[model samples]
Target chain A: MTRSLTTVESRLRKQKPDSGQIPFGRTFTDHMFVMDYEESKGWHEPRIVPYEPLTLDPAAMIFHYGQTVFEGLKAYRTDDGRVLLFRPEKNFERLNLSSERLSIPPIDEEEVMDYLKKLIDLERDWVPEFEGTSLYIRPFIIATEPSLAVAPSKMYKFMIILSPVGPYFSGGIRPVTINVEEEFTRAVKGGTGMAKTAGNYSSGYQAQEKASKEGNADVLWLDGVEKRYIEEVGSMNIFFKIDGEIVTPALSGSILRGITRTSILELLKEWGWTVNERRISIEELYQYYEEGKLEEAFGAGTAAVISPVGEFNWLGKKMVVNNHEIGPVAQKLYDTVTGIQRGRKEDDYGWTVEI
Target chain B: MTRSLTTVESRLRKQKPDSGQIPFGRTFTDHMFVMDYEESKGWHEPRIVPYEPLTLDPAAMIFHYGQTVFEGLKAYRTDDGRVLLFRPEKNFERLNLSSERLSIPPIDEEEVMDYLKKLIDLERDWVPEFEGTSLYIRPFIIATEPSLAVAPSKMYKFMIILSPVGPYFSGGIRPVTINVEEEFTRAVKGGTGMAKTAGNYSSGYQAQEKASKEGNADVLWLDGVEKRYIEEVGSMNIFFKIDGEIVTPALSGSILRGITRTSILELLKEWGWTVNERRISIEELYQYYEEGKLEEAFGAGTAAVISPVGEFNWLGKKMVVNNHEIGPVAQKLYDTVTGIQRGRKEDDYGWTVEI
Candidate 1:
């Protein structure tokens, strides 16, 4: 699958950031993967070119129609200097799912994955050696056709860029406050919620901005229909520990099907814990809090393996959890996931791919 | 804004398409208006430059977060060699509203309008003189900052481009068939539905493509909450003349506030016709059809002044209207609106602005 890709080395490599404290998505590596798709040629001319700016026609459909999809994953450097990727296949599979929903032509996920591995192998030194630092991989496809029609684009561009990111939390995993979003909807039942397309992300920026202004980290998104059941927290799928069991919102068409959420569920199942993927409304959660049955809550995603929730302020009413500190369950899940990702623990599930 | 602009004309102008029959969004004028925004300095550097490709980082927020807004309008060339724009302020005003929702910086409507007139003034010859042919104007703002953070971008780009379009109906205005979309939602309450943003447009491509494959011109989008009440027809506002009353869906927060739809309502009111801007469900519309009182239906937008709806296929059940032909009311409205635009008739409402 990597045979069709041509490689072009950069004349000058960028100065790698200090291995001490790196930031997210601000700096890039020396090279990137690029591909083009046309109605006549399909997807062709795969290449690894120098990291540079993209030249696009002023009327490209991506700037007008928001026809784009993306995926996020990371590559870690273990203590023994081995590079590993966690469930890279899942991200590309979801990327194709997103492209399909946006009416963009599908890609060969396996072939693209092979090309991605080859690119990463060439830049193996870019993966940071810090305990919490890793090289972040961003793969996105954008509609590049120069047209103003309200239909699907006849041309597209697929790209992959690498950036080194620090730990999401500067110090350690700390519980943060969230605003319960009731006035704004994240997605609708028949909308692009289930897909990882760009449209599903920034539409909730207003609510998140308002929440952040109120001294909260993010907002707890509710269902689009009744605005009752919980959908997600910020950009991650959410889970609650209540009634001595784990409960999370089911994949209700309008909720993102997160890869991290699936991994967490599998981990819990292997440990023989009770987990229910069903609708859990804000009202029911409040009731559980009143009865002292609501234990703790956290968000799950690729960026942050487990983000513990400290408090929820719903319309000015507060529900404090675990006395505003990280709970035992969240701590355990974080340690286990990060341990496996960094090769500090045994690879029991064969989830890591080494380069 | 016009005073801040600098001009650079193209040295080699491409031959213009022949005037026999033009297409939509395929050809452009020689120059375009470009502006930029940054946190340190607000929107600046307004210039009319040669129409060329834009150079941007591959990580531009527009491709990742979909934070972009746009508007559509037309410039008409009258028989007297004068160029006129139909209610240009309305489009700019809507563009600002869209910017507010998308969290992008807003531009001065009056100032930008002045700049737009200058751009169109320089390209006056590009506005075709045929009856239905006009210069289609597209004003858009995209997030240009090269970042991957999930928040409002700190930098932006604002530009306006012009394209020459022939009559929407190449021959006579033909009625179109619409599919009632019950499985996919275009927008939802508390969403970006009212904003003329990119995300709200292309997210409906899947449904629109499905409808087109079924031999329908477009889909009849319903309310995102209940999927019952009528919302829109593809990219336009839909109206139904039922039981001697003209009723269109209200500006429910989940529906687009179309400029042409507003003009049509204003004309109907001036003509002393019964009009209702409230929710009208598919069930009630079907009931009206069953009672033989569904007088006519049409879609209102900038590209197509009036797109008559002759058939509706809802879940395999069909309802034919107006004997599958354009109705008298649609024809009259189109004539009066376009007449005022081209200065063929009196500008009774002062809707036309001559350049």
Candidate 2:
């Protein structure tokens, strides 16, 4: 699919925010990438244009049916001014998987990667120079057909937008508290849990908000069917270490296959650490904690890389892990991952792409 | 809170589609209702505006998080030029319930009803007079906050768009064939199943599309937990007649509380019919079929008030209901409801609201 690229630069540039005050997703770059899809022409007219508001018919299917999917990744700036992206192809691959599940048409992954690289190169100046700050890239597709029929959309708009964001954890590395969700379930087996679609996130607002109000940083969801086994936490994949082994929930058709989770697993295996991917029930975890075998727990995602879980509130009982401090395993994983991301360590895995 | 109304009429009116060719949600009225909500200031600046495209930032929370909810109803034009709405308040009440589940601010039901009435009266000419045609009204709210965080939006836009639509069943009142879904559960017991939000619909598209490809009109979703008990069919609540009694699935925190379903149950109980709302498993229903006790089956929703089930395919075995004909109960319910809506029958239930 050979396509010509068009550029429309912004005439008036907005002032950049201070690095110290940079917030997540509150600021945008000057340019954005867009492409349209029709049943007849397929994806066409790929272009980079000035970032602006999208004009859509009030009856667009996306607003009513929520037929949309999105991906999030960041571009880091090295101390010497080179920009690096950590496993961006994985994000687009997941996006296509989500599109398949939602019945949206697929895009050319190779071509889109080329276009994404061009987009990042064009917006390279927006990449923050601070150690922890980076340019966040959001690639999403929305159903734009103006109809009320409950079916797959005939028209779609795929876009890539850039936002300069501060560190996910502003105050530095800290262990957080999580509440075990017993009433609400995020996704079930044989559902859209594996897909990174908008519906999965929206359905979790109630549980997430409730947890926030109860003084917990996030909610740790259990399996939808039995409600005993651990699934994931908030928006990240969770891992638990018990009896000197790392255990994470296996892909059960209802858990998001986070890239960071996969990378962490690979790193642990390469280091000769015992890693297991299987169902770990809440009862079993509690029993392990009582026996002093549970040593560490953390969440893995693109946003925070690795967020340590210091405490968990299950029903009425509270269990503190590692005395409310970051465990050695969690700290090493975070440092190694972030070090590779910022180009401070050797890229032996060839995970970073320089543009 | 009191909200002042403003009007902006379209300079040029769109040509109305032929009554016979009017497709569902394809054609719109000249004006629409709009309101905005902020964290500090509640819903304010309620107004009627010309039908036009909406401009939103690329990073709006709705596009990424799918924090959207909507309602569907219609306005019928009687033979004597009078317009009637059937239990419009119920739709708003359900919308608030969905708002609460999605962490959105609730709208004043009474005040919003007044605004809806004014908007309907202003566009009264757009209401179709055809027997089976009416003006389809869609009220929706979307998160407008420009952020990529997974939390609920701090800003929202509530709007109502009117589309003149023909009957859902274009040919006639023929029964529809549905396939029993063996995979892909729609919602679970503690999920967002009761909310009429966008995620629920989008997540079911895969199952619906697969059913359509298998020569079925829709998919009959079973319970998400065990996939044994019946839940719903496509977007409607389902009912079955076994041994001369009507049985529908009770609201078990997962099934939608459909207004039409409620009305049908009320009418049946008032007429001295045995109606039961309880769990009905697939195995039990099949057993009743084998004993020749299964008589009638139908689905109820706002679009198609009563859709008879002609046949059901479960794991390649087909069961034809009433020789693939519309059952007597379904026909009667459709007639009674449509007649009351069009003012041709007595308003014994006081459901019709004249505009």
Best by lDDT: 2
DockQ of 2: 0.85
- The parts of candidate 1 lying over 4 Å away from their true place are B1-3
Docking class of 2: high
lDDT by residue for model 1 (B38-106), tens: 999998888999999999999889989999999999999888999999999999999998888888888
Q: Model 1 chain B — which ten-residue stretch has the worst lDDT?
A: B1-10
Using Cα atoms, each model's DockQ against the true complex is 0.86, 0.85
Clashing pairs in 1: none
- List model 2 lDDT by residue over B229-324, tens digit each: 999999899998888899999998999999999999999998788999999998888889888888999999989889999999998888888889
TM-score of 1: 0.99
Cα deviation at A130, candidate 1, in Å, is 1.9
Q: Estimate, for each residue in A13-74, the C-alpha lDDT of model 1 and write its tens digit.
A: 88998874986788889999999999999889999999999999999999999999999999
How well does model 2 score by local distance difference test?
0.91
